[model samples]
Target: MDLEKPSARRQEPEGCLVVAIRLPVRIVALLVVVPVRMAWDALVVAGRFLNDTVLRPLGRALLWLGRAVFVWPFVGLWRYVLVPLGTGLAWLGNVLLVVPAVWLYRYVLTPSGHACAWLGRGVLAGLAWLYARVLTPIGHALMWVLKGLGAVFAAIGLGVFGALAWLGRYLVVVPAVWVYQWVLAPVGRAVSAVVTGIGVALYWTVRVLFVLPAVGLYRWVLAPVGRVLAVLGREIRDALGHAWRVAGRISLAVGRFLAGLFRWIFVEPVRWVYRTVLTPVGHAVRDAVLRPVADAARSVGRATRQALTAARDSVRQARADVRRMLFGEPRQREAVARREPTGRETRTLGSSTTALTKD
Candidate 1:
């Protein structure tokens, strides 16, 4: 059988057909509404593109120029001008504050020497006034006490001196007087008696000798002996004089010989040895010993420097090796690739990335 036509089978009343026609009217309204919405969306996109492409760059340029002219100038001025000005003002403030205080302190605090002189004069005047008003009575009182003490001391001193005087009289003076009278007086009288007897005998003997007429005989005997003795004394003096001259000559020769020996042995030999041997020997020893020591010190210093250099190099190499072992070789290839520009290659890569992102 043939399928019935959908339009022929539909049994729509006039009012329902009118309603279906109104549904088409609503669809037509949507067409105008969708177009208006699309137009509004397009205006928003255009406005954003205009702002980003034209206004944003202009604003950035204006901001950069404003910073260069205004902000940067002010920063330079602050660093170079305003800062120093402010510092000078601060220094001036400090000087103004401190100078007055210093002046005030100098004015208020008096110098020690001047103040001390004034104080000393005032104290002396006050002391003199006090002494004039009160010291006489005080002095009298002191004198009275001193007088009483002096009287007591004098009484004690007199008692001591009296005892000493009594002891002298009894022990010293009386014993000395008794010894002089009893012992020394008898000895003196015996000496006087012996002396008087010797004088009497000597006088008798002199008288007897003088009466015998022996003076001429004594003169005759002694005259020949005196002549003989005078001759002997002259001979003895001549012999001593000759012996003294010979001894003086011998002493002069010995002294000359000893002086020549001393000059030869001590002075000339020592001079020759010092000039020829000791001075050269001392110089040679200094050069031989000190030169070798100085060279050895220099060699040691050079060796130490070389050893330190070798150790430093070894440490640096070891550090490099350790770094390589731990972190491996750095990716210098990536850095080199970044440094080496290939324009077509970069463009191809950018296009491929953009295509992938779009897909």
Candidate 2:
């Protein structure tokens, strides 16, 4: 028995129109895109080379120089100069503004605030007493007088309101209700029925005259045309994309050939010269000339340093001798013994020095 591998997906059937359109479009696109792809690859290679060879080093050097020239000086100013200046200004402000303000608040403003608070409390107490003893009684008496007058007015108002309600029912309300029930109700029903009929007829006429034809035109004509246009667009896009990718592969092969040619022609020879010619020449020059000069300079620096040391010693000896002759030998200072033991005379674990543990 033979086993067949399962297919990942099924292929769609293509029409003659799609096959005809795809081939020519892809051919033309390939012709147009090959040069552009090649040029793009060349630009990418040049940008990479320029970045590695020149721009990266230049940017690093500029960054270091900027730190030295601009950034470091500003940092030093902030750390050493501006920081101290700001601290001094802060101290001065504390002395001039903060200290005095604190003093004023503590000595002058605090006492004045206390006095004002006391005065406010006394005034509030007096207002409270006045409201309770005098104003409250007067207000209650006035309210009692107003209540008696309101009761009398309310009785009069009730009588007048009842007469008005009786007159309104006969003169206005009853006539309005009779007119609505007998005249307006039938007229409104007739108008509403006529509007309902007209609305129904207008809806059916619009559906037959406009809506059904629009639906049929869209379904039969526009939708099919739109589908055909969409298929064409999709095919053209796929062809262009396939052509671009094929062109890029061709461009890559060409680029590789050119790069190999350039390396063989230029880079190999320059590398050979640097390795074979320049390296030997530089080593010979360093051994023959630079090494001997460096040795001689080191010898001269050693001799000069020794001579300076001897001269300094001689000057110090002469100063010492003159000072001894002038002062006629200085008296020796008397040594006084300290209570603490010296390093060699340190107490062992078995030994004791305190009064309670003396041995």
Candidate 3:
């Protein structure tokens, strides 16, 4: 059978009904969508303003408050209270449990283990000696006696087995083979033939009554109807999509016009007032008032710092005088002699200095 190529499949021509339906549908969709698109754009702008002015700051404050209330206490407990407690517990366990365990293992258990191990080795050696010297000859004699008895029993068993086999062949095997060949084989063949004939007839009856009609209905009626419905749905979807995009462009142009009008009326005037009026006023106020106040504050801070330094020195001098009056002067440490000569008494290059002559 030859298969059709993809390009060989032709598109159905659009009828007048579809063309008529499309124009009205698209017009209705565009009118319905324009208002919805503008509303959506307004909602977007409002949401952004609300987020920037109110919700974002509120969320930050809530986050900080939550950290203070919920997170900081747990962090402080882990860092300050629980961490120290755990450290102290670990130290106490090392002192009370680990130290004793180590000592007991080192001094007590080690010697006891060694003694037990030595004892076990001696016991094992004795058991090994007993097995090697006492048990070997007795085991060999017993095995020889068992081998003689096994040979005598084997001869008797073989004769009995042979006689039973001869009887079974004549009584059981020959009769079973005869029945299978003459009686069962013919009956089985007849039953199989009847079943095969019934199955063939049933297959053909079901095909004629049910399967053929279903296939014919799908090929002749249902497929064509499905194709028509699919084309109509595709056209409707395309029209709606095209209308929505055109509405969005129209919404964008309207938004730009409104924004320019608002900027000209409100924002530009506010900017002009700030630039021409408020800026010079603010600069004049800063130079006339704030500069004098800052200079006086700096001078006051310098005088205060000098007074504090003077007071600190006076207090230190009084403390020293009180100490001298009460306990007298402190004793000075005595100087010790050194192997190297002092700087004032050092030898010059003209002076002869040897190890023997130095003393």
Best by TM-score: 2
Ranking by TM-score: 2, 3, 1
**Model 3 segments more than 4 A misplaced:** 1-21, 273-359
In model 3, the clashing pairs are: none
Model 3 per-residue lDDT at 120: 100
Per-residue CA lDDT of model 1 for 1-359, tens digit only, reads 21112355656454453444444444444444444554554576678999999999999999999999999999999999999999999899879987877776677655655798899999999999989889978998999999999999999999999999999999999999999899999999999999999999998898778845576656777776776566555434433444344444554566578779999989999999999999899889879997888999999999999999999999999999999999998776453446433665454544553456633
Task: Quote model 2's TM-score.
Answer: 0.72
Backbone N/Cα/C clashes per model: 0, 0, 0
lDDT-better candidate, 2 vs 3:
2
lDDT of 3: 0.87
Candidates' lDDT values, in order? 0.75, 0.89, 0.87
**Candidate 2 residue-wise lDDT, 1-359, digit = tens:** 11112357896897887666666766776788788888888899899999999999999999999999999999999999999999999999999999999999999999999999999999999999999999999999999999999999999999999999999999999999999999999999999999999999999999999999999999999999998788778866776677677778898889888889999999999999999999999899989999999999999999999999999999999999999999878899999998888785566787876778865
Backbone clashes (count) for model 3 = 0
Over 4 Å off, model 2: 1-10, 52-86, 197-209, 287-359
